[model samples]
Target: MPMSEQRYLVAARKYRPQLFRELVAQEHVTETLKNALRLDRIGHAYLFSGPRGVGKTTAARLLAKAINCQTPLDQREDGAEPCRRCEACLAFEEGRSLNVLEIDAASNNRVEDVRELRETVRIPPQGARKKVYIIDEVHMLSNAAFNALLKTLEEPPPHVLFIFATTEPHKVLPTILSRCQRFDFRRIPVENIVARLREVCAAEGVEADDESLMLLARKGDGALRDALSAFDQAVSLCGTRLRYAELAQALGVVDIDLYFQVTEHVRTGNGAGMLQLVERVVGAGYDLQEFVIGLAEHVRNLLVARTLPDLSLIEAGEATRRRYAQVAEAFTEADLLRMLGLLAEAETALKQSAHPRLRLELTLLRLASLPHAVDLRRVLEQLDRLAQSAPEAPAAASSSAAADPSRGRTAGLSRLSTPTGSTTPQPAAPGSNLGSGPFGPPALQVRPSEKPGDSLAQATQSAAALMVAEAPEASFETLVSRWADVVQQIKQVRIHVGLLLEESRPLRLMHDTLELAVPGEHAERLLRNQETFLITQLHAHLSEAISIRRIRFVVQDRSVAATSAALPEEPEDPLELLRRLQQQVPALQQLIDRFGCEPLWQGN
Candidate 1:
């Protein structure tokens, strides 16, 4: 092939920024340089440092071209860009400029190289106004080389300018860094990279969609040169036209749809589907680590969608943004956070694991099987609803009692003793009738001729009924007296909270607030966490006598007295202990009767 036919430059080099204004995502560096030129405050030495392929070297070259251009500074476009038609700019463009020297510091990093550069720097410019020395990868220079160049860099000739480019400024000696005006470049944004890719595609006459261009930019991971390189490779592979699906497949990039499928499987708890997805990924030669990374980003986007009112934070096309919004509706932010955490762990593990495929499979399965997190707000809402419906129970009980005079007295007595919302059946007196009601145990009928003093049992029951029926308004004394029953009722609902309450005592009841003295801060925190539930239980048990709207737990230095003092003491004898347990827990008594249980004495 002829030399002219073979002269094809890569997109990265062919589309390199020729002017300061053309540099992408580097406004700070460009604006400062343009102002320096405009104000005639150009420094003797400049250091350009940033990540690889973020226009550090390209900016250096453009600065050199602009400084040596024949056009007057005030007459140049933007007062910074060089006129390509000028002799100095044309020489720089054709890589034949005598004034602008771009040195590869990586290859010439010895002290001898610095001596040679110093000798050359003393020479006057052959044709241009300034002698520009651009050292690429200046950090690769040896310590001796850096020291040798320091004096020249600090006190260069008035017509000479030095520009250094490096990915790592830290590796360069601090003394060398102090001699240069450093301008740190930043990674280009995805939007900016995509816009540049659009321009490149138009120039190359290649048809590409927004999604394909966005994917190419993301695959670049913030480097415009890298994205352009990818754009070249994509054009080569796809032959002048690029679609998202075909480009993703040809590049071995995991499709975004795969990430959505993983989330959908998690939502439905489809572990088998996740396994199948992993199989498909493996069979299709997708990189598990890259998939995990993309999945984490997907979950992060979902979280942003679920939390933020708009999808401004998410970087995707409008169609993909709408999909994220729809999928985010099915998951809470907490769930997405947990998924992201899991993916992060899996990502770390995948790098070190010998069996990455197996690890990925287990991770996906775990994600699918993740238990749905209970929302505390929803639980509180349900509790509020239950509380609102509780007061109606007493009225319904009273109405039933009025309709049946035979059982009216017993029903009224039972209602007075039983707490609202309690399902425990009240023990009946030697009854005339015991029919089961929707609430619990049916009301029992007392004989019309039975007297309160007829027997010891009857007299005790009559006195207890009278006390409960005429109970005084709630006070500190009343709370102390009823604390045992409150703890026992709590045990039926939440045993752990009941145990915590047993170690606490009622300190005082002021207005609607009940204060309890707890042993320590841990206990206080635990009790306070359940304070709302405790208040609900208290209301159910003492709404008729007390108006407890809040319960405050205090961590006091002094020991708290037990709240279960009202419980009967356990007898020493084994048989008596069993009998006491049976009396306290109705289920124990029922078990004993069902099994025909008998106490075994030591001799037996």
Candidate 2:
């Protein structure tokens, strides 16, 4: 290489913004400074603060050059942009200007440095109207240095100007900050970064596609300098041309396709596919935590896509945006939220787990195995359809019927009335629990193979049967025998009320009124709050058995005799108890058979 050969300058430095308009995504700060320059409102001290690589330091440098330029503000075309041909601007651009000094506060952050700065502030500008001092990373200055500079910063010479730039404004001394005109910069959007990269590529005669530029922008994570640095790296790796695949590979970025594949496996419930994806991720030498992070972002994108009509919130290329929209159709918003939550947990776990690969595999498998969430709207629509197809029953009759037919003697039996006014039970379907029974049908029987609509239709029929069925007359013994059914019915409506009822017992039964005993006043009060609901449920369940007009609750003493003495003793044998239950409630036998429930007995 010859010494005279042109030296390569990195994109970050080579394309640094020299003018206010050239600074990307910082209009708020730039416009304010430009207005101030046009109005000749130059402040003695200024501060710029924001995230890294978001043009804080660049804005500070631009403001310094503009204020010190020999070109008069009224004569300049842009008003704020310095004339590069002028002696002051040319000297500053060439880094030989004695009037404009840029200092790295990170290295020279001691009390002596502030003392030296104070000494230099007294000297007048040689060739420019103002001597500008731009301090980068001003927060790095120690407390003593900050205290030493505070007085000078607050009341410096009219010819001296101080500009401070820092990523962390909170770390800067409040006293020193109060003296400066503060301007906060914002993170550059992905679109703006991509557009800037495109300009860079065009200027350098390098060819790059949209996807490649998007990848670089996203890799930068809201920082223009970082994105530009990534662009430089991509150009170095791929010569004059850059594509998405090679650029991603060279930069060790996990391809967005892998994230899509993970979600696809989840949609299909393919645990094996998830395992293979994890294996591929590991084989590619991708960090498990980083992969989880990327997957979380992918899930977030899907969530946004599923919830919003357009992809305005997403920052992917047009093709990738279309893919997100297409994939989002397969998932509900709830499912995407759950996936994101799971991925977030996995991300945290991967940070602390020794076996990251195994953790990642377990996480992906869990995501794949996640049950599809049942949409309440769809269920309600199905119910509405079923309701429309079924015959309408009287509202008063339906109100008196049991809500759930599964717990009564007439669990699955449906009945039809003859013209002669006699009711006859409909023949039961083969392999169904429904049959001719003493009581009418509680609910219609549904098979596992039936669609959701069919099941809803059967349910509607069961409800109709419950509404029309005649209540059979019974003795007090029947009410006692059906006490558990009444409690279960209450549980289905309000579980806490049912649980409270479970703790109480029947003390005695009057001609038209019943008195129950509870263990404590708290239980009595809680039950009292639901007295009306309890009364309605009791009337619906034991209307034929008993005609109780009013019910009273009493607190029983702990030392009192057990309430079990009032009711019949349950059979000691599990088989005998089960048989007795089936005899009292035929539906219990069907439930036991359908669910394969085994009877277990506890010995006293």
Candidate 3:
């Protein structure tokens, strides 16, 4: 009825691999089947197991054809394959071979089906050497069905060869499994898929770019049938003049360039750029969850490309491979591991998220902002070595300081910042076990509260007098004893005032007032101005409160040139304060000298 009309075959059906050599990435199964046939060692039963669309069924069919080919003598010794020109091959090709039966066990998995199959197995072949029964998705058979078929499977009729193909081999009954020789088929590599697709396109007179072909191959996820399906879809949509953009648009897949750009953004620590890229992805109507998945895969590819020397492991075009190699050099193995771990976490969380776009953006932002993780092992090893060397240090250091209880004098107070532009180590607190060392960080000393008041200072005087009456040792000497504490206390209020106090020492400790000698008048100016603030902090800090009526600042004879008299007897002017500060601190002087620095103050 349709002699004048013809129908077009899909790429998957049209270019299906007919010969063992044509099977992509299934050489193991092909070679074994061919070898078994060559040695006349064809078994009674065979089980093909692997992922879907990865040649499990195809291998089973090919094995069946090879076993029953009319020209068995033609491939008697080696390279055994069905000659398609022969009677049996032609019958199989035309789907009219009574000897070869393919059953979708998913639709026929019942005890009755097994009983019917058992009855069919008892019959002998008419023309072929044996009758082949291929059961696809054999695991779908019910337990009763499996049990019913077990006996016949174990000791089948000599002319009947049972071939089972399933994605899940574990679901097959153990009894059934023992009878069948299993062949596990592997996923086709991207290169193999591309190679096969190129041949198909060439034969069909289709024009396609390598990038577009690669996209189709990758979309298949190592399934040649799936790839052909994708290829057919791309060819149909793009009318054989296939471009990468059209293919990507047709498949709704994010381009490799976007993934690389994301990687580049991560490498460069560009969170904004990564966010922008995500915005574009979202605006284009791509699934955020799928994008996250692809990004995770992209990161994995980079990790593999960076770690492995073999480039064949990565599934992409040559330009993409080169880009991966080039970009992979930017991240170390540790960084790649971190990136993968982060992406994995993102992917797992992305699956259940209701707001996937937000989650994806956050994940990408976090990845983009992620600094290369430190090698904790190396750091721990270094710390262990430091700890080992630490015990010997105090022994060497103690000899350079106080020797006996009689000479257990406290070191003078020091400032965090000094006029010489170098930091001085603060004196250790009383009863502290930690001695001064260059290794450890500067210990933090608790300072007085910064609440603005002179109430504490006034209260301290009366308290000190009472304490002195009870214990005569709690006098002006007590005040000088905790002077460093006072400076630490003052530091909390104003670092500059604490620094000013560091340049001076207690000259005379009278009943009430204390005299301090500073090297510069500038130091004297600052100390005079912040006297109340210092005394308030000191009153709160010191254990025994000693009253300080006034802090009398006088210029002491030191190395620096004297500019003016020590005390001008005036609350110093603001401009005069800046001049004095610049004169006292070399850093401040250099700032003015180099950067044309000046003091700018606003008055209320």
Candidate 4:
């Protein structure tokens, strides 16, 4: 039966490294072992740990042969590579070496196996300088077996050596590790794996592209053997011309180009674009989980590239690497971190979800919309534009403050954006120990109520008792101005609140009564929800029983600009409200001109 059928040799079996020099990406482990053998400073037990199929067992076997090489390098008396023609090397390779023992601990993990092994260690080697027992999957041994083997491992004979190889080193007992010299093998890098695979393909006369080799290398997860196995599959599926599409389809993996396109959508905050991309991907029959994993990896690469461009260690083809370099330069570090976090979270959600496609689509939408909504850069840019158009005169800016109750005066108010977008330091409130005096936010002044002047006094005292009133002189305008300031503070707290502030425009104040206008009937209902809190904040700011009333909003269309005449009126220019204020209160006129307060002028 065997003679008639053809035997297909797997790439893993055919390309296994037979000697130290042939091992790829593991020179450190081999060179160190060679040096130890040459110096004759070898330990009784040696532990080799690393990812699967990355030469742990192979290195263990090599060590055994090198120790017993008769015609060794002998620079200091021993050699680098074992002499294959030596009695021990030939006997070892033939599976008939008396002193070289290989045990698969995975299947033989019991106290009885350990007891039998303990007994075998008592006998000496017949032909070699040292008796070597190599145990693979040492981590799989039972706790009882480990305990039973512990004493012999700690104090074995000088002529005996124990080699333990495991994919998981932490699972092995610490007591056993203390008695051995340890070597941890790393996952081979993508470039190194691809190069090795290329050599194997050429030797086998298989034609494959660099892209296909990269996909195989990535699929291997750092194991050379796994990469070779994937290579064999690619050879059968595509017959040596490895195209990226065919390779990914064959292996159930996503292509790199898709990742690049998805990242561009995220950077632009295009939700529709992201959803379209997801629909196309799903329609193409790619697995949602596979796409999620690939997307997460792509974000991770971008983050690495953004944070450490010089130190980024990627294993992609030249074209793909250059594309990554361009993407890295385009995104900021903050954007990358946020994207990575979002994608990682999405990956977990995608796994648990029954409708993974829907979840993926939602995740993409979230990523795409983030750039437009809460980005710090966008907020700062808006504020910068406002600042540029702001008037140079402190008075015009100050009047701008008094004109809009939603923009108030506070010590830190300068850091905030004005309605027009400029940032300017605001006057301190009156009685504010904040180092700026009366021109500051007007002290909690109470507007006099007509109910015998004592009623306003009683209300002011009550407000002060409530800790809302600061001790400041009273005036009707001061109370109105301060209440306006509190409204502005709340506006700054949230944009929705700020929009509400615009809708609730201040109308006028008369005899301890304050009135505001709500833009629409719907807005009036919304304002009612927060009426109680709003009144309390106003009382704290006004220190008076200033009632708030909301009326229908009215539109006022003026031919002349509302802010046109802030300066004193001349004969040629109509003498507006500013001239009138100057006529009635000459002292106020000095204050207005001195502080550069733009005067209100009467239009002809």
Q: Per-candidate TM vs. native? A: 0.67, 0.68, 0.62, 0.62
Q: Which has the higher TM-score value, candidate number 2 or candidate number 4? A: 2
lDDT (tens digit, per residue) of candidate 2 on 1-604: 8879979899999999999999999998888999999998889999999999999888988888898888888788677788888988888889888988899999999999999999989999997788989999999999999999988988899999999999999999999888999998898999999999999999999999999999999989999999999988898899999999998999999998999999988877789999988889999999889999989999999988888988978889889988999899888777888898898899898888999888999999899877555433333344456556545643422443456544332222222122125444343332232222211222344556866544643564443333333222234567778888898898889876777677677866654557888756656777888877887888898776666667799987432233334436754666675666554433345457757987776767
The CA lDDT of each predicted structure is 0.79, 0.78, 0.73, 0.70
User: Candidate 2 — worst ten consecutive residues by lDDT sum?
Assistant: 433-442
RMSD in angstroms between candidate 4 and the native structure over all alpha carbons: 22.6
Per-residue lDDT over 176-248 for candidate 3, one digit per residue giving the tens place of the 0 to 100 score:
8989899898988888889888999999999998998888888899898999999888887889688898779
Off by over 4 Å in 3: 1-4, 72-79, 308-310, 373-604
RMSD of each: 18.4, 17.2, 26.7, 22.6
Candidate 4: list runs displaced more than 4 Å: 1-8, 75-78, 267-269, 305-312, 328-330, 373-604
**Top model number, TM-score:** 2
Instruction: Assess candidate 4 and give its lDDT.
Output: 0.70
lDDT of 4 at 499: 57
Cα shift from native, residue 339, model 4 (Å): 1.7
Q: Tens digits of per-residue lDDT for model 4 on 1-604? A: 5876967779887676767888889989988887787677888999999999899988988889888877747532235787788788898887898898899999989999999989989898897889999999999999999999999999998889999999999999998899899999999998889899889888988777777888899999999998888888888888867888888888878777789889887765567888888888988889888888888888777766666655337667777766787787667666678777888888888778988888998888877765321232332343344345433424444465566767422211222223245333243342233211211222223344423333322322223322222222234355545645766776655445445555356665532344566544444566667666665666666655444432233333221233334544754444455575454433344456656987655555
